[model samples]
Target: MLKFVIPAVALAAAASTPVSALEVTKTATIAAAPDTVWKTIGAFCGIGDWHPVVEKCALSKKGDKEQRTLTLKGGGTLLEEEQARDDKAMSYTYTILEGPLPVSDYKSTIMVAKDGSGSKVTWSGNFKAKGAPDNKAQEAIGGVYEAGLKGLSEKAK
Candidate 1:
């Protein structure tokens, strides 16, 4: 009885570790040029057309600067503060300010590369869920991301 109890406790401890440290990445090839795709994606408050879950996005703040807020559908909002950007690198990172999502330290960048006559776009991020994000939470985030990329591909063309 003692042996079984010890092992069970150890297993539980390992399972309880916070599910924070997850990276979800998705990529696609767009028919349009990288500049065109970037223009559509980098547009603040214009994400509603691409992100399926984001019913609308309005600029909570304005400026060619860091830190901005975007309100989402279903009573959730996110704050993004820019980390870096370069036309040559085609990448940027932002931290989240507020939201219902489990992720805490969330930052992502979209990179573009010339693939033959088209452009290859890669979206990647690393974050840790506030607590433990169930499978449903993970799937929801992933689906939204994929939908956004697909929408960009279609609209950019």
Candidate 2:
């Protein structure tokens, strides 16, 4: 009887939980070495150099964590904080502090790995849609990845 009661309470509590995150993942392959790709995108501020939509990136520090404010081409700013980075692993994770993307609680990671004579790149994120439909939010982040990967591929070549 006690086991039944506890299980019922747990299920009731879980049913009351709110919100779900929408996930997005995108991948690309570039004809560059993994280490070279990491060098191209390793720095927290290096995104401004390769991301097509990012006009410039200004970096600041919040204690030990690094933050970057990206200036978009048409006039918008995206502020992000570095969560963790691994140069040897060719990966970095970050969270959005503020941005135009239609997402809340946004977190993303980009990774690079060697594939034959080239590099494979991946960008992925999870967030709950804010003020927009879920599909719209997905499209926004997906478009950013597509453009960024395209730019990186061109630059790496």
Candidate 3:
């Protein structure tokens, strides 16, 4: 009984511990409307068109899920899986399967909506830092989203 009780107490304590997740959000305003912006960036593999870092993108389907393999400009690759997409909402969500980014269990969403003067595009993600400080990981992902949004906004113009 003593052996089992000790293990049970330790397990309960471990279960009570808390874990924190890092998050980043970046938004941009495009000159076009939501429909036009969605047409430009709504596709699961469309990042190559608006993101400067993505040189090329190829999409594949395994079962019902869609996956995209992005070849980066300088010579790296990222694999992502599309979790959900809604054409009516002009939004899509995806998860990072494998990537060069210093993150793990990363899930992201990209959406376009109507702003006051133009359409707004938002890119946001939640993840856990992997092999890097939380701030460092956040900064890396934040920079990518910022650049991507900037490129998309300019391209839409």
In the range 22-84, model 3's lDDT, one tens digit per residue, is 899998888898888888885899899999899999999989999999999998899999999
- Model 2: colliding residue pairs: none
Best by lDDT: 2
Q: Please report, in order, the local distance difference test score of every candidate based on alpha carbons.
A: 0.72, 0.92, 0.91
Considering summed lDDT, which 10 consecutive residues are worst modelled in model 1?
57-66
Between the candidate structures 2 and 3, which one is better when assessed by lDDT? 2
After superposing candidate 1 on the true structure, give the runs of residues whose Cα lies further than 4 Å from its correct spot: 1-20, 43-49, 60-65, 134-137
Residue clash pairs of candidate 1: 20-128, 20-129, 21-128, 102-130
User: Per-residue lDDT for 87-109 in model 2, tens only?
Assistant: 88999999999988889999999
Model 3 RMSD in Å is 5.8
Between prediction 1 and prediction 3, which has the larger lDDT? Answer: 3
Per-model clash counts, in order, read 4, 0, 0
Which residue ranges in model 2 land beyond 4 Å of their true spot? 1-19
